[model samples]
Target: MTKADLVENVYFRTGFSKKESAEIVETVFELIKQTLEAGDKIKIAGFGNFIVKQKATRRGRNPQTGEEIEISSRKILTFKPSQVLKNAINEGAN
Candidate 1:
């Protein structure tokens, strides 16, 4: 579901105003982004973990020109799902 869908569900469950729920969802997303930008890992039990990984500089070839270029190092965000979540998905296939 999208953020808006989440906000609507939360508002209905908590008896919160639509605006308040929207703000809460926005705040949570902002914090998640800020934490990731800071190179920290976030883990939620039964959900998944978000990690920032560093990639070393490497040489890459340009597809069009076939010219070799040095690719700069960068940080990439990755998610690893929890075992519980993985199992749940797998179980549904049976």
Candidate 2:
């Protein structure tokens, strides 16, 4: 779902005003972004871990032109879900 949906869900579950819920969600997102930008990991129990990984430069091809290119190194974000989250998803399928 989108951020608006998340804010609405938070408002309903926490009995908070829509504005407050939005602020809370925005703040959480900002914090996560800042943490990752600072090269740190964030682990939320029962959810997952957010990690930043550095990738080295690699050779790549331009699909359209069939030309070879060098892909620059970059930092990427990754998520590893907790077992609890995996179990919940599996349970819903049954």
Q: What would the TM-scores of all predictions be?
A: 0.91, 0.92
> Model 2, 1-94: lDDT tens per residue?
9999999999999999999999999999999999999999999999999999999999999999999999999999999999999999999999
Q: Write the per-residue lDDT of candidate 1 for residues 1-94, one digit (tens) a residue.
A: 9988999999999999999999999999999999999999999999999999999999999999999999999999999999999999999999
Off by over 4 Å in 2: none
For model 1, what is the C-alpha lDDT against the true structure?
0.97
| Prediction 2 global C-alpha lDDT | 0.98
Off by over 4 Å in 1: none
TM-score of 1: 0.91
